[model samples]
Target: MLRLASLKFGRLFRYGKLLFAASLLVVMLLNTHSLFSSFQRNELTDRRFLSLNKCPACFGSSWCRKFMNGQLSFEGWGRLRLLDFFNVKNVHFAQYGEPREGSRRVVLKRLGSNHELSELDQRICKRATGRPRCDLVQAMYKTDFARLNGDVRLLTPDVVEGWSDLVHCPSQRLLDRLVRRYAETKDSGSFLLRNLKDTERMQLLLTLAFNPEPLVLQSFPSDEGWPFAKYLGACGRMVAVNYVGEELWSYFNAPWEKRVDLAWQLMEIAEQLTNNDFEFALYLLDVSFDNFAVGPRDGKVIIVDAENVLVADKKN
Candidate 1:
C-alpha cells in the first residue's frame, strides 16, 4: 500500500513541475516579443527623419494625395512617420500641416477646422482619397508643416488659452520707439532692430499685430471656376488657421540671424501692405513674424495661415 501511494505522489509532483516550466517559457517569449516591438518602433522613428529630410516633395499634393489613396503608405514611405509628433512639428512641408499625437494619428489641424481635426482630416482624406488600409494603421508616420503647392493647411479656430499669460502687450511708448526706428530707416535691410530691447521688439510686434489671428483674404475669380471657392469655402468650417511658423517662433532652433531676418521681413511686410501693390494683394492684417516665412526662392515670403485673409476691397 505504501509503495503504491509513493508512486501516485511522484506522478503528481512531476506533472506540476512540467506545468510550471511551460508557464515560464510562455512568459519569456512574451517579454522578448514586447522588447522587440519597442526596439523596432524606435529604429523606424530614426529612419523616418532621414527619409523625410531627404525628400522635400514628400508633402506635396501628389504625395499626400497618393498616400491618401493608399498608393502611398499611411505609415509614411521608408518608415517616414509623417504623422509623428516630433516630425510634424519639424517637417515644415505642408501648406496646412498638422501635428499628430504619438500613440495614434490625432490630427490637430486640416482644411480649416481644428475642433475635430482627427475626424476632419480623416474624413477629408477619405473623400479625397479613399478608405485607409487596415494594415496601414499599424504603420507609423512622420508629418510636418512643410510647404506643398497650392494646398492651404486649414486650421480650426480655438480660444487663445494663454491670453492672461500674455502680460506683455506693448505699451504706446515702446510702439512709438520701434515704429519710429522702422520708419526712419530708409533701407528695410538696415538694422532697424539694432537698439531695441527684446521686450521693446516683441511689444512693437504685438502692437502692430493687433491680434494673434489674421483676418486676411485671397482672391478667387468666380470665372476661374470653383477650385478656389471650394477650397476657401471649406476653410469656413474651420474656426481659424495657424498663423505661426515653427521656425518663426524659434521652436525648431532656426538660426538667430535667420530669425532676425524673418522678423525684419515682418516689419517690411507691414510697410509693403500699405503700399499700392497691396491695394490688390491680400491684406495680411495680422502680420506677425510668425505668420510668414522665406519662400522657396530667397527673399520670398510665404503666408502660412490659410484662412482669415481678406481681399483688398474688403479692407477698403
Candidate 2:
C-alpha cells in the first residue's frame, strides 16, 4: 500500500511541472509577439525624424509625446496636438500658406474649395500647393499672447492664464493700449501684414502700432473683397478672443454658445464705453494665448481665425 501511494504522488508532481512549463512557454511567446509588433509599428510610422521644432507643447516631454501619439486622433484636436509638438503657437487662418503634413493638409484641401471657404478667402489659402499626407487635425486658427509692461510683465504661461481667467473682461490697460494704437495707424495703411484680408489686415496693422510685436495674419492682396482700412476709425472697444489651443476646460470653460453670448455682451460693453458702433471678431478655434508675444489690437476685435465664423456650405 505504501509503494502504491508513492507512485501516485510521483505522477502528480511530474504533471504539475509539465503544466508549469507549458504556461511559461505561452507567456514567453506572448511577450515576444508584443515586442515584435511594437517594433513593426515604429518602423512604419518613422516618427523619429519628426522634430520638436514642429511641436513643443505636445511633444515637449516624453509623456505628452506618448499620450498624443497613442490617444489623440488624426483629426480635429489630434492634428493640433501634432503641430503643438513643434511649438507652433500661431497657425492662424489668415497666415496659412504652406500645407503641413498629416490632417492639416487635408483640411487645407477642403478649404481650397469654395464650399467651406469663400473663393475670396485669400487670407488662409495663400499657397495650398504641394500639400503632404500626414495624420493631423484640421487647424482653423491659432495664436499666443502675453502681457507686456504690466504688473504681470513677463509673458509666462502663468501670466497668460491669469489674463484668460478673467472671463468677463481683459485688463483695462491692455484695452486702452490697443485702442490708442489703432487711432495712430488708421491712416498709415501700410504695415508688415499686407497679406491679411480686410478685417484681418486692419487688425494686423493695428496690432503693429499698439503691440509692435511680430504677429501672423492671413495672406492676401488688395484686390480681395474685404477692404477694412477705410472703415477703421468708426469702431469702439474690443474683445480678446481667449482660445487656449487645447480642448482642456481649464483654458476656456464656456461652451461655444456661451462664448458667442459673451462676445455679444462684450460688444454691448464696448458700445456703452466708447459710444461708437462696436465691431468685434471671434477667434473661435483653439488659440494659444501664450504664443502671441504682442499685445491685442484696440478698437478692432478682428477674427484672426475667420474660418470659425463662416458656416461651411456642404451643398454648395
lDDT by residue for model 1 over 173-261, one digit each (tens)? 22232234332123322233434333223222321222222112212221232111111111111112222223344324667776677
User: Candidate 1 deviates by what RMSD?
Assistant: 21.0
lDDT of candidate 1 at residue 101, scale 0 to 100: 25
The TM-scores, one per candidate, come to 0.29, 0.17
Candidate 2's residue-wise lDDT over 1-316, tens digit each? 9999999999999999999889867865767765454434432122332222222111112222322243221333323322333333323211112224322111111111222122222322232222332221111122221113123322222322222211113333333333333322333333222222333333332233222221211111112322111111111111112221222223256578755654564455334323322222222233333322211233222222322221111221
lDDT values for all models: 0.32, 0.28
Off by over 4 Å in 2: 1-49, 53-63, 66-69, 73-152, 155-280, 283-316
| Leading candidate by lDDT | 1
- Give per-residue lDDT, candidate 2, residue 253: 63
